[model samples]
Target chain A: MLILQKISQNKTLAATINQIHYVVIIGEGLVGGALRDYLINTFNYKFFYNVKTPWTDKTLIEAHFNELKTFIFEKIFNSQKTELAAPSFLQLSFVWSAGKAGFAASFTDIDEEEKDFHSFLNLLTQIDQERPAFVKMDLHFTSSAGGLFEGQSSVQEDSQPHPLRPYGILKLRQEQKITEWSQNKSYFHGVIYRLSTVYGRIRRGQRMGLISIMLQNGLHKKITPITGDLYTLRDYVHSMDIARMITSGMISSHKPHKSPSNNLQVLFGLSQKPTSIFEIKAIIEFHLKHKIYIQFNHTPGNARDITFGKIQPPFEVQARDIRSGIKDVLTDWYGAHT
Target chain B: MEGTLSVSTITPVYCGAQYLEELIKQLERVRQEWQSKNYPIQIVESIFVVDAAKDDSLAILKTISNNKAYPWIKVIELSKNFGQHPATMCGVLYSTGDWLITLDEDLQHHPREFIELFKAFAASSYDVVYAKPKDSVHQSLFRDWGSRGYKKLIAKITKNPFVIDFNSFRLIRGSIARAAASVCGHETYFDVAICWFTNKITTQKLSLEDQRYINTGTSSYNLFSLLSHARRLIVSSQTKILRLGAWIGIASILLSVALGLHFLYLKIYDPEAIPVRGWTSLYLTLLFMGGLTSTLLSIIIEYLSSISLQNQGKPLFFMVDRSSDALIQKFLNHEPIDH
Candidate 1:
């Protein structure tokens, strides 16, 4: 109670008000952990995530609702603290993570829609419950690419979700949903980043980032049995740069100012420069200083080469080159937990 | 085209016991036609989803259960009747095939069209082949008008100029069908969902003869029910009201001014039309305005329902573990390995 009062009155605290937002990432994957770090130390926001689960456990159904309720009442409402007073700077700028997005989609595997959809709902359950007043960002990543290459660029903010696969389609539908969820809610503002392909994190799981997989295998001097094709390039950006850009967005809420019709800002977060698989392989090979075997089935068409430079919102940091990024990730990989 | 694609024929039977005989007759004929001609597609399975049928549908299925004559037939009896769409969704939930097709059990939509749907699907890159009713013999003028009007109205509202021939009789790529089926909600326009899930949709024209035996079969829908379905479709499939509201809002402004001027002209230029009874005009004005206000309120509620559905953390569909083998394996791989 005393801490809340003292913090509210503290000008120094208010000055860095852009640093006070918080979030709970339920999926403890690379993106989830990165979002947590950005919100805590980098952005310095406070948050509470109720649970983390592997997949479709019956427990998540309850955990989702429970944490969402707590966020709505105890955390979000309590965070506001004053009436009509402009939130301190830290509370603004941006609050987002380009977490669950798929690059390519196909007609097979409709069940993925069910699984990916739950994550969206879990997040929404949190969004609806917390209805945060101070924070202005409800940034999410939906499958924007599926609807793009499926004949035309029908992936507008209002276009129907033409998901080739269940994952991309569900994610695309989630874009419409979050837009609808944030509308007239009066609590928090929203912005969505249509991230291309994020690299740099050295996550070790079955669903590890593709770049990490290749780099990891190269570091270990093994052959990476790559899926899809070699020419399949994506707008891969380093995680730290992505985080820095997100922090910058949370700090400055200008450019595409908030609106009722468009509180949901959509940005295709490429590195302002794209990286292809061949380049990525070369970079990894150079960085590791080893002869990494090259294996190409074919270059997949999942990588989108569309334009996204119009709403190029400013960021504070630069994304690393795939070559340099491979070295950094390798160093971090061995540095942590090794 | 090898045309060897197997078909999963699904029929969502509500209180449609009367239509069962004709529906089965059509299916039997279709089975014979495809088998005899060696049609490119083979009958993978036949699913009769009888939801809450008070009639002897369970008894009917029992009569056929032991009969080895029908190569592949699956009867799923729901504990209770879950309504038309839900019942249909239940069948979709149970179906397993490369191509999923549905038709009205009332026999209004013939089984002869199945071959056409299959042929088109096999010969093209289209993910979903949308069937349009080329002719309707059994529909009354009122029903036809209602159907056409609803189509146009929903199209205007959704802003997706859909072909008018949309019905239960259609063939969808198995993947698209499952994708649309996965997000199955209690209430959804299944056809619109198909469009939302696919890029290539081919439209085929067909003719329907009159369905005479609809009397004994119970119709759970009235005009009010029709309106409700239309309401649900308009709400879920499209976000037309904000634009509609803008148009109506402008119209209201224009109408209010025009009415105001007319009233002024009447009061100033000619006092005779007023009837010298102040209560009449006052009551008339109040009545008109009251009705208009109610219409506006209902529109607002419909918009709010869409917003709530969209915003609320609701899944498009839920999967039951009754019969999904592939899904089980996929789910396993996604989970953490014990090692």
Candidate 2:
């Protein structure tokens, strides 16, 4: 057995594992940043969040990954041992499961979607290979539920994923590869969380997240158009709720003697309620105390509506109502603007 | 006002996010000014083709496009960092206007000077009008001289008359610009494609400043980028230098043939006139071999040049609109010659 011990500190591997939980979150975009903030503020976990900086060359990405690996190793080696029981290593990554829509717009062109999947798989492989020694690491991977299991009215953790779009197909492939890889590793506790339409206050001018787009347009007094009419339904979940559920799930259970067959687990991080675009717009208007100008177009490229099953987590997690979430987002956005 | 020609301005952005806000503001001001004047030419859209900039230029472009003040702003985020010319061509392909203007995202090409270019076009029948700086260009002396020398060399080598006056800040007719852009391959020099389409190209003198360089004290283009541009320019034009090689080959062959005939005449008619009998034969043999080698090499070069020109879409014959010369001469007489 490879024992990872702190050379400078008087601590055994098992004792150190019991003391502090080190979490490394990769791709510090909207979702990753929110999770980091929630974990730090609520649970006070030590985190090594890797934020992508603007790079001009390909070598910079490799350099950054090396730096992150060194940092993770050093953190694991220097942590003090305690008597409290907790998992030692935790890794989370937020990836663009849908990729750039323009590249995957045409269903016939699977090249870009394939490229996104390969890169995603490569990152997972790197994580699996570069994890700290002598520690059972709990790896929580987040993917888009809506983007993966497309054309389904209701989706569950065990739903037969039949994706119609190239983006969805690529995401499903990534999930399968992760599952296969996790089942082969005994010490790796991999949980795949398929999140629904996540919304919150994002950076201004960001084109992602429907809620952010509507709010930015409203603030700028521009008419926002809803493609494929207002009846497009989606399970809208707040980023805060997502962060809470993920953190709770990470801290909830530890089964040490689990077999390779049961090493990988799947969860749906979704709100059971499904809201239409019309309802969302109405909620935003109520929160902002003004009517947002909206127009609907009969476009064919809108994402197929999806419903979520009950979010059965090992621990109890409460999700904010859609209206309250919108209110919170608006308050934050308004505060930032003012 | 209804029948006025609409214009679309295209700027290929690469690491110019710092000045993007000011650029958009100036563009908006120009649009408003044109609207107030009831100008016959109106800027219908300002298309920004962001070539995966190293900075947050895409974000800035998105912000500008989202602004309510500039309804005509369009941002095209390219998947990769294609060079400026290819990015400009991408924008031109997406544009819908009567005329298309291509400029840099940096304030080097001032938005206010669109009026001057418009006036120049109005005065002439030229389809393309380039805005050339009359005073010193806002770049290092080395860069300015290097660019001038490269352009002159390219013009002389390709026998292309319009390349010497080629500038990024140009106002081109919409249909011609789009058609030219559509035919451009990955290796096509965009300016050469414009020249291939029309010879009715002229220049307007302007006093422009590179504000970005002034602020940052650094240029976006370095030695490597200039060399890449030079390579593209040479590849996209016909190799008149190769043709010169072919001419030299033909002249050598002719000279050798004339000398051989004279030697044969001397051997047949005046046998005693050759003082050194073996020397004459040796000299003739050397001349024949040298001529043969040069002729063969030149032919190979000529063949290679033809292949390159074919790939570059060089047509055997193209129609020219000579009637535009009268309007061009009139415009020239009215315009002041730049020193």
Which candidate number would show the highest lDDT if scored against the true structure? 2
**C-alpha TM-score for every candidate:** 0.41, 0.47
Q: For candidate 2, write residues A1-338 as lDDT tens digits.
A: 01112121225533323334555554445566677667566544443444553333434545665555555555553342232232344323232323434313566445554554455456546656765443445656677777776546535556777776776665676678777766666555666777788887657654357887787787778888766445455778888887777666554424443453336667787765556665566566656656677766655557345655333543457577777888888888778778
lDDT of 1 at A270: 51
Error of 2 at A171 (Å): 40
Clashing pairs in 2: none
Q: lDDT of each prediction vs. the true structure?
A: 0.55, 0.67
- What shift in Å separates residue B256 of candidate 2 from its native position after superposition? 0.9
Q: A188-269, model 1: which lDDT tens digit per residue?
A: 5555565546666677664567789887787777788765544333456666666665555544443334443435556545
How many residue pairs clash per model? 28, 0
Error in Å for residue B99 of model 1: 41
Error of 1 at A269 (Å): 0.6
Off by over 4 Å in 2: A1-338, B214-217, B268-279, B289-304, B314-339
Best by TM-score: 2
The local lDDT score (0 to 100) that residue A58 gets in candidate 1 is: 45
Which of the CAPRI classes, incorrect, acceptable, medium or high, describes model 1? Answer: incorrect
